[model samples]
Target: MESDKIIESILNDFNSFNIDDIPNIDLYMDQVTTYLNNKFEGSKRNDDDKLLTKTMINNYAKSRLLPPPEKKKYSKDHLILLMMIFYLKNIISINDIDTALSPLIKDYFNDGNNSLEEIFKLFIQYMKDTDDNQSIIDAYVKSNEYFSNLDNEDNKEYLQTLTLIATLTYECLSRKMIIEKLIDSLPKEENSKDKSDKNKSDKNKTDK
Candidate 1:
């Protein structure tokens, strides 16, 4: 099918940000946004869509999803974290992103021996290794086959579309469940610990 060919070709040439494209020197806000915008231009649903903006970056920093930039300039590690945030924001909440990645930032954000760059490279390699284009093709085939017994020509198109939407939604939700479970497994943040301590203190005071 034409869609099968298109999906295969697109997945075969799936693009991801290259680590080498990151400059050694730090970047100002404009440069960071421009670089990401250019790199992910093709992924935009609309031509005028902005993937990353200064306001969004600032908000991320404020929300602690991104580490603060040094002297208003972002480092390579900052870019790497932003890249991760960009990819995950579409699938998960910003708070969840922080829960999932804050530990990494605390432990390995600046660890030269265990850098975020190395992790990013490994993740990109994993995507390449796990490219399963056939599964997607099968999904489309299944969507097309749904409601084949329905003889109403007018309802057939709508029913097939509904089946496809349902199938995709199921797949997305199933994967989201796994991701949320992994996030749930991460160590509680210091703030959460502090809150727990505060609650315990309050309880003790009430008992006294």
Candidate 2:
């Protein structure tokens, strides 16, 4: 009665889902820390460095978003979501990041939500359609449930960064899903060999 099982069954029944859509989550997450370090390259953003400032952390919590590890700490599991955020910042409303992050945060990065995979699938579709659209700013802005608590102009940059970080959170989630689906698509040598041998033996038996 697992949720993915239910979804897989439905996809199989309707022929809308393919083996290509399944994901290998564990392998993808394992590489996140290293990938993040490369983004910083020579910069020293250690995992223990507490990349998120106190205000940033509070903003994420209030907006129900997540901040990634800075220098040393990083989570590959969250990489896809981070990438999506980066994509959004350039094309969509730079102010509504907290809204995009809500889905991942609420679903625990889509780890085990009953509808996690479906939501991820939806988000991917959304990205594909709107990732580069001009109305992206409006659509994204209207999508937010967060009414900012800020009244000071000095906090604009802080808010913008928070939004950017939230978008990153989303990128991590989406990228992770894509990676998992790609991994799941790989054929298993053992299973393929077993099936091939069985077919050969059955052919021999029929010939006899």
Candidate 3:
């Protein structure tokens, strides 16, 4: 059997989460583990992990990454950071997770509670600038192209979103919706080349 040692080592980092920050696993580990296992596997080793020593825990309060506790008491926040490390090392290609986490950390510090809006917005910005999201989209499209089964065509959500876009599009062209805002929501000109492409969606909801 292939050893699960590497996987355990990577996961072992998350187990050191401060008990104070995360009261219980039920309170916090919602998407963190899912994000972790989705990114890290038992096998692949990239050059990046060379420096990502097991002696680390994400200390968001101090705005720093430091050595893990001796006994390894896990918390939800720490696990979230572990999930981020997995993404930085494997999925998303940014030099470090500390910088990648800064914006989210900044926003949470400002509000005392993290906002999903700011988090995803930062993610979108990163993906757009760093080719992360685009690569994921491309990979998904490629996967769909090759997979034998994917014909469960549900255009309801697609059509509804499209309807909203059409409404916005019609209004924009007719001088009702703001062109600048509509442009922000519209698909990129190059990406929108295939006008008939069903999967490509443009979303723009304007004030009526």
**Which candidate number maximizes TM-score?**
1
The C-alpha RMSD of each candidate to the native structure, in angstroms, is 5.4, 20.5, 20.0
> What ranking emerges by TM-score with the best candidate at the front?
1, 2, 3
Off by over 4 Å in 3: 1-39, 42-53, 56-63, 66-72, 90-96, 109-112, 115-208
TM-score of every candidate relative to the true structure:
0.77, 0.29, 0.29
In candidate 1, the residue pairs with backbone N, CA or C atoms under 3 Å apart (3 or more residues apart, or in different chains) clash, namely none
lDDT of 3 by residue, 36-55 (tens): 44334433466344323232
Clashes of each: 0, 26, 2
Q: Write the residue-wise lDDT of candidate 2 on 82-185 in tens digits.
A: 54554454444433444445445545663664544455567667645563433334333433324345576446445644564576568667866675565456
The segments of candidate 1 whose C-alpha lies over 4 angstroms from its true place after superposition are 1-17, 145-162, 192-208
For model 2, the stretches where C-alpha displacement exceeds 4 angstroms are 1-30, 33-64, 67-77, 108-111, 115-117, 125-208
lDDT of candidate model 1 versus the reference:
0.80
C-alpha-based local distance difference test score of model 3 = 0.40
Decreasing lDDT order of the candidates: 1, 2, 3
Question: What Cα-based lDDT does every candidate model obtain?
Answer: 0.80, 0.46, 0.40
- Please state the error at residue 81 of candidate 2 in Å: 1.4
Give one digit per residue, the lDDT tens place, for model 1 in 1-208.
Answer: 2445555556654544467988888999999998888766666778988899999999988766787898999999998898888889989998898898877888888687888888888988887677655567677778668767788966876776666667778988999999999998888876444656889999999999
Query: What 10-residue stretch in candidate 1 is worst by lDDT?
Result: 1-10
